[model samples]
Target chain A: MPDAPDAVEQAVRQVLTSINGDLTPTETMLLGELEALAQEIQRAKREISALSIGDISDSHIPVATDELDAVLAHTAEATNEILDCCEKLENTAPELPEGPAAVVNDAVTRIYEACSFQDITGQRIGKVVTALKAIEARLMRVTDRFGSVSSAPAEPQAPDTRTQGQQLANGPQLPGNASSQAEIDSLLASFD
Target chain B: MDKNTNILIVDDYKTMLRIIRNLLKQLDFNNVDEASDGSEALTKLRAGNFGLVISDWNMVPMTGLDLLKEVRADARLKNLPFIMITAESKTENVVAAKQAGVSNYIVKPFNAETLKEKIEKVMVHA
Candidate 1:
């Protein structure tokens, strides 16, 4: 049986034919694609609306970024405490005999060097936070499509004008691939 | 190099600044000042007599590269020795710093020896 939409399409086609002679193949194909897209959109709306989408974004995702922030703060605090200990040890190391003082100072200096791990870790976590926020933004787009966030204005998407990939930092490289201090020193020397 | 050379260490991270300060102290550089970002460091540089700058690469509002360019552009601070001490150890970043007139570059997790060496190297021609 011909469906109700087919009946309406036939009526519209007849009116267009009477006015403009006949519908073009491209226009007919476009109308068909529009109807199919409308049906797919409705199905997607039902499926997305059925799941508790808000909980994933509002409850779980934001907490992950917050937890990352906490880890950065805690590590920074812990590293500072470690450095403070080194500072105190440094101040007292001069009182010891020369040999032991050398050992103590060396150990303290090594500790101070190791404390920079916190800075690297903090930066890595910051990158993670940025990635998580991007995911949250995509989820918000889905939620908005479902009219769950109808009150908030939709984000304006910039038109893609270029075909080239975005120039951005692809980080956390494996060992031996990234630039080492020696390599960096060599590069700097080339400048002179 | 005189132990009294007034040096500036710039970084947004408080812990890093403290670590660098303590490392400098160990290197016999007792005269040191700190700035959390590049802009503040620029202001301090303009107002004071600073011999060297040890700055981190990453910062908001103004980065170490921005500060370096600004310093190089200014007549008074143009000749001031600048060393970049940063976790940004990329080859391109190093090249950029070199081109921007940075005196020496130190990748992070460095020791007092590295700091002392860079300082001595920069100060020799200062």
Candidate 2:
């Protein structure tokens, strides 16, 4: 009962459907994938929230930089102290016999040369600090794009429960982190 | 090398400046001045009459290479002895320093003898 054009159109549509097959299953599959992706994103956000790798404030970056700088400062100070001793000895070397003065001068010169280690180490640490700064900048950009999902800083750490030997020991630490060498020596002496 | 020739030592690290100054003193070159960076060194170079410039290659705001170029470009400072100190002995760094009119180069962690040798090689005093 349909008109000729309508009939032709319907026949063409039937042929196309037969060739292409039904599309409902494909559409359902796409929607299912979208829903799965949404769930995955939520899970990732939760995982990120649980991670304690510093907050969006990135206080860690500056702290790390300060630690590196402290390394430089401590080494420089020690090296300078050694150099001072060497220089003092060298200054008084001329008052000694010629042979002994020559020997002392040679030793002092070697010490001065070795003191260069501080400069090399400082340069190496400077490079690391520079790299950390660059990484922090990238992190800032990422945080800008997809804000921080992490929780606030953790609570204060619990008191030490380890035995005497198992006590926390990150010796050779930064300026304020651990006790000085003199303190440790005094403590070890008292323990005797 | 004239022991009394006024020398300018440039480094951002105070320790390095002190070390170099001490070494120069051992070499009997006590007439030395210090600058913490290239820009400050430039100001001193323009203001004083320094026979030699011993500078570290790396510094903020202005590098030794930049300072070398500036010195070479200046009519008065051109041909003044310039010794570059680099932490690494990379070939490209040597080539670049050479191209920038550096009179000589010294790699880091050098002994007094080496410093003396380089200073003797580069420094030309009137």
**Best by the TM-score measure:** 1
lDDT of 1 by residue, B15-126 (tens): 8888888878888888999999889999999999999999987776678888898999999999999998877777877777788889999887677888888889999989
Off by over 4 Å in 2: A1-39, A53-59, A148-192, B124-126
- What lDDT score goes with residue B78 in model 1? 94
Candidate 2 per-residue lDDT, tens place, A1-192, comes to 663344544555565567776636765465456556656766665575465435633688888898888888889889889988988998999999999999998898788878877877887787788778877776555444445435556458799864221121111223344343234324323433
DockQ, prediction 1 = 0.50
- Model 1 chain A weakest 10-residue run by lDDT: A162-171
Interface alpha-carbon RMSD, every candidate:
4.6, 17.9
Model 2: which docking level applies?
Answer: incorrect
Docking class of 1: medium
Per-candidate TM-score against the hidden true structure: 0.80, 0.72
Runs off by more than 4 Å, candidate 1: A1-39, A146-177
Worst 10 residues of 1 chain B by lDDT: B86-95
Calculate DockQ per candidate and list them: 0.50, 0.09
